[model samples]
Target: MNRLFDIFRNKYFLSTAAFAVWMLFFDKNDMLSQYEYRTEVHKLQQEKDFYEIETAKVKKDLNELNTNLNTAEKFAREKYFMKKDNEDVFVIIREDAKD
Candidate 1:
């Protein structure tokens, strides 16, 4: 008990404790701010990864469309509802689906 009291009474120990408290709570970049920054970085990293995957898939599709005429026609027919000049186009929309 006496030793603990002496330690607390020491100027160096008190100064160090005060500095730690200041840095942890009072500094411009405190613990909470650092944690928020880290979380924001993680969220942005995940978004970047998702976008990269989507970009790769789009590039692959573009390559396929550029290389294959049949695939391009199929894509246009299915995606844009395009039809031949002599054919009639009929669009069937489900009740639950949006325009």
Candidate 2:
């Protein structure tokens, strides 16, 4: 008991314990920062996955449009409202029955 008390009362041991507590709770590279960075990394990974899926869809569409003229023309006409000369274009709007 005396030896333990002597060690606990030592200045070096007290300083070391205080430093460890400060480092664990108040340091720059603490647990909170690690959790925050992990959350940010997970969010970025989700965004990357979404963008990759979108890129793959676009590439597939591009490949289809490159090989199929009818698909290309249909996409152009639907997306851009493009039409050939002497073509009669009609716009049909459907109102939802619930609305």
User: Best lDDT goes to which candidate?
Assistant: 1
RMSD of each: 3.6, 3.9
lDDT of 2 by residue, 23-99 (tens): 87899988788889999999999999999999999999999999999999999998788999999788788988994
- Candidates in order have lDDT scores of 0.96, 0.93
TM-score winner: 1
TM-score for each of the candidates: 0.78, 0.69
lDDT of 1 by residue, 1-99 (tens): 999999999999999999999999999999999999999999999999999999999999899999999999998998999999999988887788577
Candidate 2's C-alpha runs over 4 A off are: 1-16, 85-99
What ranges in model 1 sit over 4 Å off? 85-99
In every candidate, how many clashes are there? 0, 0
- Worst-scoring 10-residue span by lDDT in model 2: 90-99
How far is 28's C-alpha from truth in model 2 (Å)? 1.8
